[model samples]
Structures are given as C-alpha cells and as structure tokens.
Target: MARIRIAVTGTDGQVARSLVERSAMTACDVICIGRPMLDLSRPTTIESALASIAADVVVSAAAYTDVNKAETEGALADLVNGRAPGLLAAHAYARGIPLIQLSTDYVFDGSKSTPYTEDDPIAPINAYGRSKAAGERAVAAAHPHHVILRTSWIYSPFNRNFVRTMLALARKQDEVRVVADQIGNPTAAADIADGILEVARNLIEGRNEERAGIFHMAAAGTTSWAEFASAIFSASAERGGPTARVAPIASAEYQTPARRPANSRLDCARLSRVHGVSLLHWHSSLGPCVGRILEQGT
Candidate 1:
C-alpha cells in the first residue's frame, strides 16, 4: 500500500507545527509550506501551491487568528482567512483531492445556551469571526470533498496562546484578572490536528464524506477565560513553575477592540460521530502544554 501524501499550509503556525510533528507517527508523507512559501495574502499562491504538490489530501491550518486586531485590519484578515482557503478548496476540487479547512467558534454569536452544532446559524459578532465564516462558506461552495472543522480557544506550547500568556503573567505578577463571562473549550492544537488527520484520512479513503460539513472539534468540557487561566496556573504550579492568584472578572472589566461572545462553547457530537474521534478534556491537555511553556521559560 502506498503511504498517503498530505500537503499542509501554514507551516509556521501552531496548528501546522503540531500536524508536522504528529504526522511522522502515521504512514503518511507530510508536506508543509510556511507563510512566505505560500502566503495567504496571495490567494493565487494557494492554487499554485496545490498544483505544485502531488498529495492525496490538503489541510489548510493557516489563518488570520488575531481576533482583536482583525477589527483594524479587516481586509487583510478576510484575504488570508476567507479568500485563501477558498482558493485551496477550488484547487482541491480541480485535482479531485480532499481539503480540510480549519475554522473557529467565533463564527457564532454565542447566543445559544447549548453547544453550537454544525447546522447552527452563523452570525459572527467580530471581524475575525466574520472572515472565518466567509472562508467556511467559500470552501463549501468550491469543493464537495472538504471538511471544515470549527474549533475554539486553541492553545499550544509552540506558539503565543492563552496558556503561555497566563504562565508568563503568573511568573511576573502576584495576581491576574481574567474574564469569566466568555465560555468556551480550551482546545489543544495537537488534539485538534489529530482530529483533522482522522477526518483527512477518512476523506482520502472515501469514508468521511457522508459526514463532512462544518463539524465542531473542541475539548469536551466548557470553561470561562478565568477558569482556563486558573487551570493553566494550577498546572504550572504542579510543575513548580509559578504560583500566583487568579481573580475572576467580568468581560466588561477588560476592554478590547473586538467584541467577543459571552458564550463560545461548541458541540463536538457530530465530529465524534463522523470522525469517530474524541478529544481529551481541557484540563488533561493543559498540563503538558503548560509544562512545555515552563520548560521553555515562556
């Protein structure tokens, strides 16, 4: 049997880094292209990159992830997050390859009491969310063989994420205030990448298309920003890294340029049924990620 060839975009980002590291364990050949190599700003580059590679599957992990900054740079965010992945989907359609695109929980306004499912209506409150929503629609229109995985509050040891931010503050400050109103799952990049690979493998083998669409892939448990920060601190403390107090605050206390949803929780039931994959609870994934941050002195 020939090993599956998978081409991944956004090699420089956290999710891409995790995919590269994890793909080595599988019987798959991973081809990773970074920002300059396949810049999202140049949508044509997405098609060019796909045409240049001979892969059974294409995974687009690259995105404009800065939510607050997206308000000021909406056009740039839309270009990278919306248009680029659309081009990749089109290219994949032309080549008869499966494209797996990463999306976000920000696509929904967080008005739903329960976790948002794949069929939930999208009404993004922020620029970044809107851009990702656009990307989701574009990919669906361009490619029939595609998986749009909507995840939330992703963190990894490799990049600048919430876990790192909390650890850094705990080291420097005695007490840190985190918003408790915004609720969502704290997904690990490694875990999310694993789910992506599962979906990709199924698609490549013609088993997952019946379940393909917008599936929410997040850690099982829901948590607020304050609770998540507390988990990070608790994990760090267990590793003897930092000892600091965490204070809970309302979202109104912290002012940011972009408006965030009070409830950003996602439902992964469809993801589980379709992909036959389960995510570790946020607390379990936090320890290793926080430990890495402590080891790296970040």
Candidate 2:
C-alpha cells in the first residue's frame, strides 16, 4: 500500500506543525509548504506549488491570523485569508482530491449566549472574521469535497499562541490582565491535527461521503480569557514554570482595534456525529500543552 501524500500549507504555524509531528504515527506523507513555495498572498504560485508536490490531499492552514492587525491590513488579510483558500481548493478540486481548510469561530458576531452550530448564520464583527468568512464561502463555492473546520482560541506547545504569551508575560510581570467577558474554547493544536487526519483518513478510505462540508471542531468546554490565563498559570505553577496572578478585567477595559466575539463557543455535535471525532476538554488538553511549552522553554 502506498503512503497517502498530504500537502499542508503554513509550515511554520502551530496546527500545520502539529500535523507534521503527528504524521510519523500515520501512513500519510505530510509535506508542509510556506513562503515562496505556497504564499497565500501570491495566488499565482499556489497552483504551481500544488503541481510540484502532487499531494493526495491538501490542508489549507495558512492565514493572516493577526486579529488586531487585520483591521489595518484588511486588503492583505483578504488576499491571504479570503481569496487564497478558494484558489487552493479549486486547484485540489481539479486534481480530484479533497481540500481540508481550517476556519475560525470569529465568523459569528458573538451575540449568542449559547454555542454556535454549523447552521448558524455568519455575521463577523471584525476584519479578521470577515476575511475568514469570505474564505469559507469561496472554498464551498469552488470545491465539492471540502471540509471547513471552524475552531477557536488555538494554542500549542509550539508557536506564539496565548499560552506562550501568557507564560512569557508571567515571567516578566507580577500580574497579567486578561479579559473575563470574552469567552471561547482554548483548543489544542494537536487535537485539531488529529481531527484533520481523521477526516482525511475517512476521505481516503471512501467513507463519510455525506460529511463533506462545514463542521465545528473545538475543545469540549469553554472559558474566558481570564479563566484560561488562570488555568495556564495554575498548570505552569504545578510544572515549576513561570506563574503569575491573572487580574480579570472586562473586555472594554482592554480595548483592541478588532472587536472579538464575546462568546466564541462552538458546537461540535456535527463533527462527532458525522465524522465520529471529538476533542478533549480544554483544561484536559491544556495541561500537556503547557507542560510541553515549559519543557521546551520557548
């Protein structure tokens, strides 16, 4: 049996790297591409990059992820996050392969008190959210075999995510202020990588044909930024890493150019029911992630 070649974008990003790391245990040949080879901002280079790799599957994980900066760089964000995934999906569709694209929960306005389902109407309140929402629409329009997995508050043992940022701040300061009002699940990159691979495996094995569409894939539970920070500190303290007191503050107190959804929780029932995939609880996933981060001392 030949190994399934998986071409992934954003070689340097957390989720992409996690996929590469986990590929060792699977029969998938994960090839990660970034920058000059597969620049999202340079759409013309995408087709050639895909042709050069000739992968059995493509995972579109690269994006302009700077939420606050997206406000000032709307055009670039749109180019990278909005238009690029669609073009990549089109290329994969032409090759008769599936394209798994990573999306975000920011597509919602955060007004709903409960978890947002796959059927929820998108109404992004920020530039970053708008860009991601556009990408989702474009990919759906361009490819029939596309999986847009909407996740939130992604962190990992690698990369500059909230966990690392909090640890760094904890080492430098006595107390770190975090927003208590903005709530969402803090999903681990490794869990997301596993979810992506599960979907890819199903597609490869000619299973779950009806599950080719959008779904919510996230951690099992939700928490505010402040509580998440506290959890990180608690975990770090237990592991003898940098720990600090988290001062909870309202969202308005810590203003940003981009308006984050007050509630970014997502319902993963469709993913579990359709794909038979579900992630660990946020706290359960965070402990190991923080331990790895501390072990690396990055």
Candidate 3:
C-alpha cells in the first residue's frame, strides 16, 4: 500500500543529493533536511529542528567533510561529526526507527595490506577520521537500530567532488598530478545512495535484524587516486568532454594537513552477504556520471 518514507539529513552534500535523485526510481520517499532546519554544525539545534519529521528510517548523511580544514577546526569537526550524529541516533531511538549513519573509510589507519573489513580495528590517523570514529561510537551507543556505512573516494555529477574537479582542471591544465600510493574504491554518490536505500528498505521491512551494525558499502573495484583520475579523463575523453593527462605522484609530493591512510579500500563483502546489496564497479558507475556532468557542462 503506502510507500515508505526515508528521512535523510543534509541537503546539498553529494550523498544527500544523490539519495534524493535516486529515490525517484524506488517506491519510497526520501525527505532531506539540513541547514536552518537541521543545523548539524550546531548540535544543540538538531533536536528541535528534526522534531516534526516523520519517516520509516533516518539517514545521517550530513557531517563536517573538509578533511584538510578539519586539522585546525577539530572542535567544529567533533561537534558536527561526533555529537550531532549521537543526537540523531537519540531521535531515531525515540522514534523507534532505523538510523543509517553515513561514515567514512578514513576511520582506519590504512596500514593493513588488504582491504578493510567491518570487524577490523579502527585507528584514525587524522582529526577528521577521529571525529568520524567518535560519531560511530556515539551512534552505536544511542541507537540499537543503526547501520554505519563506511565508504570512500566519493564522487558525483552533482557536487564539488573529485570527478567534477578533475573535469574542471582538464579545461585549464593539460596534466594533473594525483597520488598513486593511496588506494581505495572510487565510489559514486549515486551508487552509494542506491545501496543506502536498499539497506533502508530491508531495515524498514524488518527482513534482516542481524544487519544492524557497521558495514562497508563502497563500489566493487579498487584503484589509486592517480588511476582513478585517469579513469575520469578516459570517460570524459570518450564523451568528447574535458580530458587531461594524470601524472602519478607519491603521497609525500602532495602533502596536506590531514594524513590520509595509505590504503583505505573497504571490503564490502559483508554488505553484499548480509543485505544482498552490491554496488556497481567504480569505473562502470563513473561513465554515466561523467556523461551527466558533460551534458550539464558543470
């Protein structure tokens, strides 16, 4: 009879925007709330802001996402990434609905040689990672019906992600230098949104009670940042859009305030095995997104 209602936090972020767009194909409503209505930056306002919302599940897709900036703005990052999620979980617990908290792969220290599993130990090496790790704890503590998804290298046609950045740079520069040492899945926001919706569907329908914990939900394949950039340009070139040569470089050459993991690739087998949801390969998902970005000329 009635379609399910999936309430998501944040409005403009890549994941949030993609979730709204992706929901059109499903028989559920994705209601996105952010800013003045759900000021995650100010954790004190989230309770009052989200008081009137009604939904089958709550998705905490909002957070302090500036990794490099987070080094100096640790307190602000903690407030938005840590305390805000706990408050969201508290609301979800109060409402008796499932809470889907969007987490990051940066939670791991990236020292492990293989792709990380859900059970792997969390040892965040940066302020942003620590803040997200804190949020995971807070969410787990506050809500029993919660799914913490750890994904990586998110890109989309809708936002200021790596995909868009690469395309924009190709217009001005002939060659772009990207790190080749750091490895992870180059996940599409739309793919992530689809996976999230499926998880929400399972949670709302009460199909799998056991799928109530952390899960890695990245796209299937893995590659270095430089390789990912090459894929972007290859697809862009095929579409007659902007294309550039990706100059592979070491992580040390392009140092930033945040020290990212050497290997952040997530093992998404748990999500596939438990919820039966597997996202498309990173390159497969990138083609259409590149097409869309070319069409819009953004």
Better of 1 and 2 by lDDT: 2
lDDT of each: 0.86, 0.92, 0.91
lDDT of 1 by residue, 1-298 (tens): 5788888887768888888888889877778976666888986677677778898998888888888999999999999988888888898889998888989999999888888888889999999999999999899999986788888898998777888888778878999999999999999999987887787778877865596787889998999998888878778888999967889999899999999988898888888887898899988888988887888974
Tens digit per residue, CA lDDT, model 2, 72-167: 999999999999999999989998888899999999999998999999999999999999999999999999878899999999988779999999
Clashes (candidate 1): 0
**Candidates' RMSD to native:** 1.2, 1.1, 1.1
Where does candidate 1 stray beyond 4 Å?
none
lDDT computed for candidate 3: 0.91
Winning model by lDDT: 2
A best-first ranking of the candidates according to their lDDT comes to 2, 3, 1
Off by over 4 Å in 2: 207-209
Give me the overall lDDT of model 1: 0.86
Task: Estimate the TM-score for candidate 2.
Answer: 0.98
Model 3 C-alpha RMSD to native: 1.1
Model 2, C-alpha of 224: deviation from truth (Å): 0.8
